[model samples]
Target: MDPRQEEQINAQVIAVFPDKVRIIVDDLEDFKIAEESLKVGSYVKIADNENAVLIAIIENFQIAVSAEGKRDHIIEAFPLGILRNGKFERGGDSLAIPPKEVQPATISDIKKIYEDSVPKEASFRFATLSSNISVPVPVNGDKFFNKHIAVVGSTGSGKSHTLATIIQKAVSEKGDGFSLNNSHVIIFDIHSEYKSAFPSANHIDISNLALPYWMLNSEELEEFFLDTEANDHNQRNIFKEAIIKDRLAKFSGSASEKQNIHLDTPILFDIREVLAYAIAKNEEMVNTGEVYASSNKEKAGQPKYTQGSLHGKLTNFVNRLENKLNDSRLNFFLGEQSMKITFEETLQKLLGYSSKSESNVTVIDLSGVPFEVLSITVSLISRLVFEYGYIYKRIRCAKNPNEKINNDIPILLVYEEAHKYVPNSDLSKYRASKVAIERIAKEGRKYGVTLLLASQRPSEISETIFSQCSNFIAMRLTNPADQGYVKKLLPDSLGSLIDKMTSFRQGEALLVGESIILPSIVQIEPCIHTPSSSDIPYWQLWKEEWKNMDFAAIKEEWYK
Candidate 1:
């Protein structure tokens, strides 16, 4: 290098920290060397006498410096880092020799090194001294928020609690302006834990809530009647006809069919009407004749008529249907014969419009639904929401796909205790929760529907569904099968973080995947809105006694 060029260079070693070093230099105009591509976390080679050589550069740098003495002399303060392998002189001034060479590290190789060196506590985000390269940083974008997410933990691992924290952070984090206000989420809350978790959403609980069974397609209806056995084609048709009649009868008196009602419309069907039709169609006629000539008197045999013969036999079935229809406790399509309330009133109340805003996050409470029907009810409601969105888009964006901005309201469905519904397999091939969940996993993304599945047993969840998740929030897992299942889905880079799952705190979780550049084990923020269905303190309740003890006096007064 030329002497004039060296004179033009202004180099100053800023402060040297215990572990790292910082330096500043003028523009490359002076060094005249081609190795001026130094950056934070990059390696730069400095050589003296060809053999006395060392390398370091820029861990971090500021555009301006603010030290007291000689602060004006330094135009910039750049930190330099040297690994334990290289040594820097304590009081070395500027070296006359220039830097040798500099190059950018391969991101792939760095990622590999990162996976191997990351600490167990690190989630998808990590910074380590094992390599000179920086781990990938998770920026808020399509890569992170738009990707699918899954949370797996045991029953009490606080899955719902963790999810609430993550969503809260996503909207409030620095540098990210993404908010949940514009998002439309439809949660299939089997346990109804999230009713109060988010206050903004419209909550629809299907307890004794009636859904028109006729609204179900033939496939759905078939699944509904899986337990009933019908042999001949006639028998099957009889059942089908009975179902149709009951449906029509249930909706008959109120209003005319606005649309050409077909086998497809998802309106409420009358279970009472259908069962009545079934009984009526299956009834058998009986004929009785008195034997008159049997005892040598030889009275002629003639047909005998009984007044309540048919009525007597049909009594039990009618009673059953009437009892079901009359059960005022049940929210049935037809009001129980015993209850004076009409079906029309119940239907109106159920389908009545709620000012549910798509922008506001809504949590529907499902705790009131009966255990026997919980799985199917959850499936039906979720399917209905997605189906509604699918239809809404087709009409709004008729000709062009790009003109779908008006139709794009992304929704996230958080399934708590997802394993109960979406188990591994269905040997009988009925209305399996696994199938419904798999459909959402594969197709929900296109319809602007996303699922956030929370479960303790990953091994019990469908492999295909679990594999589709792009981001994962993992807490403690003692089950080896679950651990092994998660291991398969986890990136090799997150091996260490997976090991920490067993020791994670109640609300703490290892967050890994696209949303985070490196895996990070974070303490989730506590939720402000409390869930309604937590365990109660029975022991404490028993400690309290009744306020009044006038039992003997009350009895004496009554006797007097």
Candidate 2:
């Protein structure tokens, strides 16, 4: 090799470590190609004499003043992966002792790492490289959606926008011909922000939502109606007994199944009938058989009566049950409409499968759901998706046992602002949702149900659910707890890169996990239609002309 060629290289490898490699830059302005100068977050390739090349991202730069008053530039970079035989494989530190050549990664080099590694048909693009906006980043679509995804950030940090962009690209991207694709997405829009984004979606609010109350499992039933604060054992036993009996007596199914009924069975059982049964049990008299004499036939036998064992025990339970039945706010799940609707019909509305409504996205606006029963609603929906997957898989395998690829119409459930219901606390109010969602996080993928959880307060989310996420889009987070919580991805070789979370601009995020070819800091592309998540321009609105108040209208709407 000529010495002049070595001098023209501009960058030289000085050192290599397990997690990072050191490089010394002879001249920063020597490279007039690659579209950019070397800086933090830039990708570079280091090669040794043995043909082993390692890909690394620049972390920080330092300037050292020599004894001769000369200045030297040194770069510290975190090793991302190694390029072997024209393919990029994750896991670094395979380079030999002293690397011979170091240079900025060309556009082609960046593409080879992010795009060429994944088949063009399997690529899903939602963002571009933060260092080079022209380079679009692609992730393996199957790995991304099949596994759970977590997107967390501070308020106004573009979490909603990121979710919208991903889903929008998914639903609109067509394969062969222009017919409807095989994509199905159900978004639990807690703040009612997704309807505007998916205008054609099957948008169901509390007014149109008919989630049956009978479908709730025992835990959800107790969490829904029973006073958790009281913790009365009698209330629980009586409620369970009443529901089982009511179901057995009313079920028109085969007698054998009725005999095998249990408290957790997802069958139709009247809550009003359960309340009536509780009332009857509470008011029963113990003065029946022996206390009544044969003299009653002639003397109208006046037999003494005693209060039944459950006389006063169920008073509070029955009263609370009746109050909840009469509460208009709770009518969405408790009313006759919810009971009349079959599980298939409910799934039709929720999955956008009904003949009347055909769409790829179903946004269940949860803002109108009563806060007290929010957990119950989320639990019921999450369980429904999981069970659908489980049942669909069973039926498919029953027909064709050779290959058990279940759930042809796979679904992804998006929980926007997930912490409101599935919080980390052991409080009984959050138990229902936490259990249902955690089950999905653990085993939903096998049955074709995956989760896309987006929240601003990630530290408050249940670890059982949050830890199972295989993909993450961590945006700007200002809170220390959130920052520290997200920084645990350090094991992915993000050393000092994770420290930049505090300063990332809106729409920029640290993209990592099993989906992408390599972890990257990316700028989320502008979504086709953004969510209604922008902050209210208070100061801008205050400059408008004074307006009259309408208290009467507000009061009337509040009552409804």
Candidate 3:
């Protein structure tokens, strides 16, 4: 240690309370030299230019002195280059101390960073974390979910589990949010998963679900009854009009009766009914001239009428409709099935049908709903919610200032298989799933109706919907496309953490966005109630099989 070297050792006490110091250097032209050459976390020594003992940069930079009390000026030694007999420190005179490096912080550290942020999930019941891997923080009116949210992931990547977990969590919250007087949730179960997952939900199995014929307008009914064989636009309308009239006559309330009248409106009729009517009329039209029936064959003199152009058209339509109804795949929408309840029953149930008391929560299960009409049913339900919200908001703010409004009640729509509805494509039109989701994403926030989407395919989800989500608890996504999609969607600050999604354990998620201070990789708490997402252990089943059964017994047992 030298005296002259002490002058070259420049340093400053930046933080006195914590005893922190900043090393002063001539030029950091090469950060590598500064970083590697200096002892980031160590004691320092210094020497003077004349190679004389100067000071030791320890508790305070001071000249070294004898152990026995000696001089007023405490001399310190500063090393020009740290020397341990044979080594030469490349950097300048003084060294800086580095903080202790911790390899990785605990899961609580990850959760706390986000939990302590704005629009915080301060007080919500903890649900199954993303995929049961990361902790799920259920948000309602008090949290950011009152705005908008989006979830994305790859197929079979536990998107459905994540969504189901959220719905369950929200329902729990609503039941617990004793302050709220009403909470009506209407989910559009596109895949029928929601219908089954939440049994308490008003399940509208589209199969048996029928809309009151009078509810449809003339144009809608026309579209519904558009004849395939009748290529001529004019001819199609004529047939459509006829079908509408028949349906109105059949379902409408009678004019004379003043109640339950028929034929006072325009509506859609079953293609079967329309076809029968057209066939009978075509026989008479054929006798007239321009319009005619094909056959005439009655009891001898009373000849029966044959099929005509109108009859054929109507008959073909009925056949097509019948075929569609018969197809098991398409039967969910048009089939005559009893597995599901009617739409009217569902609607009434949702609107406090039996209970005079307005409930704060409603779950619409789609498990019994058919696959084909799942999307359609979901769209209709979402539309109904949107329409009601619009109406309620208006009335609350309308004329009477003193009129009480149920503003505290917020309806949250949860989608279990969210990616299907908001796919990566331009789902701007031609998709019932897309339209329903987009409506919730675009307008639900304003009316206090929030949406929580859960999906595994972040890459395949619609960008519009994904971008709207301000808060996210993303689980592990190993697929590169899905990882890339989330990376693209999240903020730049989360780059370091998101890069680890592929390696994250199932149920573990990266929590970020408005609710988080810094993006975190969290280990979520387990769900209170277990959901139905579990794999069958084939090995366990095989172990139970034995040679004690005959062919019939084996077959029966195997089938069972």
Candidate 4:
């Protein structure tokens, strides 16, 4: 901050606006920056007459030649904040008519912007400034996670690695305490990529995942069992009546108490019994003096028969239900474990809680799950967690009227490739999942349940869910739609700053929102336990010797 540095003017501030500043250097050979390197996302400092300084991020570069063949380097930057009186302020500005001088921000000057703004205790450092790896970037951990977060980028842009890095840091850092922390995270890993990242996590894949058919809500049940093309009202009514009767019959309560059980209740009932009831109704017979096998036939006995009201109505419904039951892939839903598993045990598994050793993460590997029920699976799980938070909060408040915390052990639900389940489309298959997730996005904050949504295409995700995200780590997005979608969610002041997203290298991200002290371009630190997301080196592998294959084993699993 010495005034003597002003004597060596490095660049000229030609134009200054509320949100941006333009600087041009007439002599490229004598640019003489501290680092002797410059890039579009680098930070620079400009001083006004009162000795106050403004920090800006370089957005774009342009070069022009004069008539005499002299070159001028034009640097356009977005103003981030102002530093005055040894105090750094974020996004408030006042300036004298022509700024005193502009200079490439020295390392100390740059560090002051981030270090002074956030308290040491609240900082959660997982990445460093893209311009300087030595300068670490820390965000407010509570605000970042309590509020929903989004991590979006194109394929091969390190979106997976970035998410893994944040989660690893979260689980590993507990203020130099014991080996484990209460931090709980459940990742819906569509491609089974996170097991390596969290080796000790409670991993559940199709082989052992037990999602009872009785756990699905009414909407999910309809979507799973009803045919949208046929849209049969009789079939729906039959299914509803069957489940309700089945639930009532299974309840050991009084007649009046059985009235409380509805079709959508989470109470466990035999789906097979419901299927049997449907088949019986479809083949039911009634008598209206229709046909008689009488004395003309012979001596033993005689009977009259007629088709009942719903005799043929439920034929298709029975077929669909029967096919679903027969499919071996869906055994996870109808398996004996699911029928026997209690709600408390299922919750413990999802929350990574146990009397023995407990882990901080639960990875649900969906790769082995059947595709037809993906939405239903996601919906059921999300609903379970949200209800856990809601009911847990209610119980705490009931016990202690002054209890402020909803859940003593809060949980974070992460959806890798979230768009696949919660796409913007209004298709029937996505309805249940969308409703479940959208409810969380709107109300989960108070109940201590939050989401971390990571996807390659943000534009394709549900807008209601995306808009609820208070923080975003946007990496290199080459697609215009994805870029524009992100731009719309951020503040208008950051429009130019976001333009630098495409130019970022792999693992570089524009970290912005309520969590961080300042919006900045940062390089995520490499995770100690990497995910299985690395791209294959096809060319080099092809040049090497032929690799052996185990088609028998592959086919064995494939058939199953």
Candidate 5:
């Protein structure tokens, strides 16, 4: 039989709707083949007309026994798109087909579907179809990076490997040695797993990551220092006033007069001086009695002044401030040896824009940071990045209206374990980071900032943030709640396809949304430089021979 004639009518369409089609298979052998193809997530093509083919996925099936004892296989399919005139297209005005005109499509038709879906521009080849035919599955580079994306899966489902693959492919050069020179990607590495993966990238851990105390605004300071619910209003006001005064005193005469300083101004100030001023104000006496003459000439006539009304109110506040200043764990915020580093220097260091380095990727390792201050640290860094991008774009656009902007300093902010910071519950402890990240999700694209959030528990992440993601790389998710959460975020037409997510093999994922021409299940390629996210060898360690313990070294480090 000629292959072109294989498009001849094989199955008869018994029912049809706008979104679904039902076909009948009467031939015993053909019924078996159609039954095999009806498995969920498997694709099949229906002949919509002489030249147009309708691609659909088998979502369900039923076996019917007629009164004459003959068996009929009914296959229910969800239409994905229309392949017409040798081109695969979606959402066109001519997808609907009349009933009884459909025919079963052949393997040659499937090949055409894959070929027409390959992106025309620069793309990253992630996987091949499981059919062993080596059909190239490519994701458009521009759409994947410019839009916010989410990577969610259960543990050991290859989420880390997927992320590493994306980053490696992004930073690596093309065959022609063409690289993205202006791309800046910052990974918030919670487990310190990515430092080894990108050896050439700029890596900053808690040991060297410095965020001066003055960088925090009034609201952040309040969140960190004052227990607003517990602290007295008078004491809080005193602290605020002292901070304002110390910030203003950083500038002198002409500069001070011209500068408009707010509570959130980034300026160097001696924290000790602020503490001392607050203490002095608290200790100042107020006259409770009328003026009186003293017997001694040196005393002359003076009205006795009692201790200030706020003397004892600030004792606890002062003690808490002193403790934070002395704690070595907080050295990142308080251990600046000199006040000479300007705000511009701080921005350059945090944004990885200093003159010493031209590398575009910066990985911030958060493993060493104390848990008490982790939320604020993440909040401060994220807010600074957003603000810098926002201001830089405004200034550039104002300077040259017709300038060709190639996204010179566009930043891709990747957050691992995103649910910890952007939880759905309003009672979460990391409110600061949650608000900052949510702002970026809603409006960051306008300023060349995009987010790639990775989380194991998609249900726990903020709905606003998750819903705003335009792309998703969903790996195996077994938990019902997590699976349901991902399903809710996708379009109704893809729900049956998403149902297979729980059973996907490790390293296999469904890449959907704006990044690809079609929703596909891709086998993610292994990263050349893999992260240290593999499970520990517990059995191997248990089988090892006993060795001498280093008690002395352990004790010394523990004391330090």
Candidate 6:
């Protein structure tokens, strides 16, 4: 290189540490150039020696007057990884290089560094760097997704678009011949927005998404069917006994099998029959002209029948149960007419691989579902998927001990508006879904089940769940609380990047963690089929002439 070019690139390393470097900018012209080029979160390379290059990020900068009253501009950077020879090694060793050895990395230098650092296998080109030169950022798909991931941003910050892009890219076969035939992704579509994104995806709304009523465990049943706070102890016991008796009779088999039927058993049983038994027990009378206590084990000392102490107490409970049974909105659970369909069939419908003609992505739209039973519904579906995946992996592992575990068909479960279900607050009302999802977040990876959690409020999400995530795609989060939550989740080395979240564009995100070689700002590629979450054009709609309103039809639909 020429003397002038070398001098232009060279900068003085004022101070150095294991993970960070402090550079001093003295030349006015060079400082101006550095100010323009070395942006926060931008990559830089420092020459440790002729054979080794230390890569770092410009985290912060300061302008101050030195002891001699001379102006000084200092750039603080955190070392990402060291590139030695042609290979990339994580972390940097203590270097004794004198001042003026550090060089401001050029675009070509960065390209070479990224090309050598990013692995070829198990990686995909997803986004490009928003820099002077357009450089494709190849991410390790396996590493990014194998561990849990969180995609969080405020409203209108491209959270939905970023998620859609990821799904589209995963299922897209146009480039790299990536086949999603074996990929099983179930999206819990909260607002019915993603139905059109993947035309080949299996779209399941409340109309066709039937969750067998018997799938609810005891806690879920209590949460949905009986109001524990309102119901007395005897009423709850009577309800539990009826459920056990009905489930045992429905799944009658060998003596050993009958022993397995408990209150929480996931067996197909008529909910109406259980309700009838409970009512009958509530109405049953004994010889003492009193209510019969079916749950009372001490027969000798018990009042034979005192008009069934639970008769009046259970009226509200029975009324609630009846209301739920009759609710058309809850037909997904109560309207299962196909008695021939077994649990295996339901599992296949929920988790089966979609062929080329079929849709691989199954979106469970919860928009039409009633709010009261929404949590239990989500719990049932999430629990079923987790249990099925857990059992499948165990059986597969037992059958072929020598086979690789990754060979199993992986399922990616996407939870939209996750904060509604998995809140960090201990007093959250939705415990059923929270517990189910937390179990998956903690243990799903071993069984080939991954989670993609998208939320508008990171501060509201469960800390345990958020902490497990290995990759983060954070967009423009203006809220200070949200930004602080994200900052706490990130490592100290990359915490400065969180400050830039407020300025990110719609589709731009800070990609960090196990996915990329280093934390970077990426312009995510546009999804081919956008979701139905676009903002409403209020101005345009207001300017247009109003059409004739259908008052009668609107009223009738509202009543329905």
Q: Which segments of model 4 are wrong by more than 4 Å?
A: 1-12, 24-39, 49-51, 61-73, 289-303, 544-558
Estimate, for each residue in 1-560, the C-alpha lDDT of model 6 and write its tens digit. 33455455436788888667888776535533334445666666777545777777787888879899988778888887777777776666644375335656666666766676556766666677755437777778788778888999899988887788888877763445554446678898888889888777887787777777777888787877777666468768878888888878877589899988888887777778877877776576646745446676666455564565555656766777788778777777787543345677677777744332455688888898887777888888888888887888778878888768733778889999898877887643487888888898899898788899999899999888889899998889988999999999887766456678899888788888787787777888888888896578999999999878999999987776
Scored by lDDT, model 6 comes in at 0.76
What TM-score would every model get versus the actual structure? Answer: 0.59, 0.95, 0.59, 0.92, 0.88, 0.88
At residue 253, what lDDT does model 4 achieve? 83
lDDT of 3 by residue, 1-560 (tens): 23433233333222211222233332222211222232211233332233322112222233334578532222121222232232333223333333111011123432432243334334553333332234344333355556666655454445555566555655565345484435556554545454446655544444444433333334333333444235655446555556556665665456654343233242335555655655554443343223334453433344344455555444555555556545555444444432244445545655434345444345555665545445555665665566667777787877666755434455777766666555666522226556666877887777767777777666777677778888787777778887887888876534245666776665566666554333444555544443454456778888985746489987974553
| Clashing residue pairs in candidate 5 (N, C-alpha, C atoms within 3 angstroms) | none
Q: After superposition, how far is residue 259 of candidate 6 from its true place, in Å?
A: 2.4
Reference-based TM-score, model 4:
0.92
Cα-lDDT of candidate 2: 0.87
Q: What C-alpha lDDT, on a 0 to 100 scale, does residue 454 get in candidate 6?
A: 95
Better of 1 and 4 by lDDT: 4
Q: Model 4 over residues 1-560: C-alpha lDDT tens digits?
A: 44545466667899987787889987644454544477776778888889788888888789988999988899988888878898877783676658887877776778877787678777788899988899988888888889999999999899888988999999987756588888999999999899998898889899888887788888888998899658898998888998998888778889887778998788878889989999898999876654444545652244566788899888888999898888889888877887898888888888888556588999999998877789999999999999999999999999998997768989999999999999999988899899999999999999999999999999999999999999999999999999999999988878576888898899999999998877888999998899996578999999999989999999997887
- Candidate 2 per-residue lDDT over residues 299-376, each given as its tens digit: 355676788888888899989999999888988899889889997898888888977858999999999998989999
Worst 10 residues of 1 by lDDT: 75-84
Which candidate comes out best when scored by TM-score? 2
RMSD vs true structure, all candidates: 13.9, 2.6, 13.7, 2.7, 3.5, 5.3
